[model samples]
Target: MRLEGRTAVITGGTRGLGRAIAEAFLAEGASVVAAARNPYDIKELADDHEGRLLYQYTDVTDERSVEELMTAACEAYGGVDILVNNAGVSRDGKIARLSVADWNTTLATNLTGVFLCTRAVIGPMTTPGKPAGPGGRIINVSSCVAGRAAVGAGAYSASKAAVEMFTRTSAVELAPKNIRVNCLSPGYIDEGMGKELAANERAWESYRGRLLSDRLGRPEEVGAAAVFLAGGESSYVNGTVVEVNGGLLWAA
Candidate 1:
């Protein structure tokens, strides 16, 4: 196992893309702390992985809860080796009519949560004598919409766009600490949020033809990409956004 003996804290790891990443990490022999606001039927997953998995209640939007998550990881697994900032929310609305509440909600979770989790993990990950492995990794999840134009996706796009820049900045800042920060941007995937979109026949039809692969991406595909970034094989890779979108050809 490439990730044997390492411990990773994954925010929003309860479902969707986050869950996929958690599964991948577990398969690679890493101890995973699946941080999410709700348990969301994770009992079975925890049962399967047993000691390798932990479900911690974390509200990434709140500083206290995020800190507690780190503490929990440290207590349960000795220290944090990798962090996947996969927690996010999307609020769709045209620019003019978007409510302030919606905008704030989007930014608070998508942007601020990434910041909080990244900052909180620094202590545990870098602390001496507490590492499960060569500890230092952070993966931020963004979306293709961040760089493209999508009608009624102003707030959502803007928040993710900000995350991409944040990822770059964090990579530079955390370099001296030996932490490699990177971004994973997935396009139309048939899971979680993407699944919801693909459910809309009209929307799916429009997006389907634009994809070079001509099909929705699978969750395991995104999981595989995450595995590369978290593993030692990508030791030289950092501060880059790896697109997991099945060759999505979208300008808007």
Candidate 2:
């Protein structure tokens, strides 16, 4: 139980990578606060695991909503020890044909959401009388597209890139407070953000040949890496980007 007695909040934890992270944390003995817009089916999940889990409907893009999420999490769990910013979206279109509304929306949810969640939780992570741990962890879930100038994903890519920069900035600022900030940028994962690409059988076959692992990574693998970042294993690791791309983005 690497995270025994820790309290964690994961945005977008109702599904995909976020959901997997919540499960992983719970398995590691952490009490989790899962926040997302979707109302969670708590009964089924609670039955599956004999551990503590709370869900709050949250729009991460909204400051007030994010603040309320933090308040509820801290009140319920005592304090926040780890935060995983995993709320994001994608809108694919050519640059010439892209709509400003779509671009702004992507930035709002992907980038601004991270900022809102981080800001809302930072105080609890830093303030005293909170029983989280000796230090705190903030892991921003980014994408491999942030490192590559791939075609047809300008808005999504740029938003993720900005998130990385934000991560570095947060690490530098929060270091004095004993909180570490890092980014996890996965490449062509089989579940979560890459589901659309993986849904195409032909695309998976072609993609398998390119990947060093000969297959797309799974959401649980990302969850495992996230656990490492959140636990004491990554104590000295700070202001860095962990590439969970399975050699697909060797350039990163």
Candidate 3:
């Protein structure tokens, strides 16, 4: 177990990519706190993982809630060795048609949430003599749209692009504290938001040819990449955006 004894706090861990990451971490023997606004079926995960898993109700958009999540994780597992800011929301609309409410919602959950969660974990992760490891990991989840443009994705794209920049800046600032920050930019996959897109046959057909793999990416693949970032295997990796997009070509 590469992550044996390590403790990871994952935001939005109740479903989709976050759930996949949680399962992968547990398999590697890490204690996981799955924080989300809703618990959903995470109790089932708790049943399977038992002591190794915790489901904490968290609203990442609220600083207080984020802080409470960190506190709960520490109280339960001692301290956090890894923090995955995987919670996000996408509100798609063309600029002229996009409501201000939609824009605010997207930025609040996608960008501000990452900031709050990262801030909440910094102290515990960097504190001297803490029960956690000497160096901690912070993995921010971004989207492929962060680096590419698509019609109707203005707000989501902008927020994620900002997240990538934030990740780099955080990595530089936290480096001296022995905390490494990185971003994972996932392209269209077969789970989570991508699953919804794939449901629209017209949309799926239009995008399918862009992927060199000729198929949608599996959640497990993303999970494997997350494990590497959270484990010792990525000791030298920091401040980088690892794109998990199966060689996707950006359509002009």
User: Candidate 2 — worst ten consecutive residues by lDDT sum?
Assistant: 42-51
lDDT of each: 0.91, 0.88, 0.92
* Model 3 Cα lDDT, one tens digit per residue, 143-211: 998988899999999999999999999999999888999999888888977898899999899888898
Model 1: per-residue Cα lDDT over 1-252, one tens digit each: 888888999999999989999999999999999999998988899999989999999999999999999999999998898899999998889999999999999999999999999999999888976644444989999999989889999998999999999999999999988899999999988897788878999988988887888888999999899989998888899999999887884433
Instruction: Tell me the tens digit of each residue's lDDT in model 2 across 74-123.
Output: 88878889999999989989899989999999999999999998888889
Q: Considering TM-score, which of the candidate structures 2 and 3 is the better prediction for this target?
A: 3
Best candidate according to lDDT = 3
* Alpha-carbon RMSD to native, per candidate: 1.5, 1.8, 1.4
Whole-structure CA lDDT of model 2 = 0.88
TM-scores for the candidates: 0.96, 0.94, 0.97
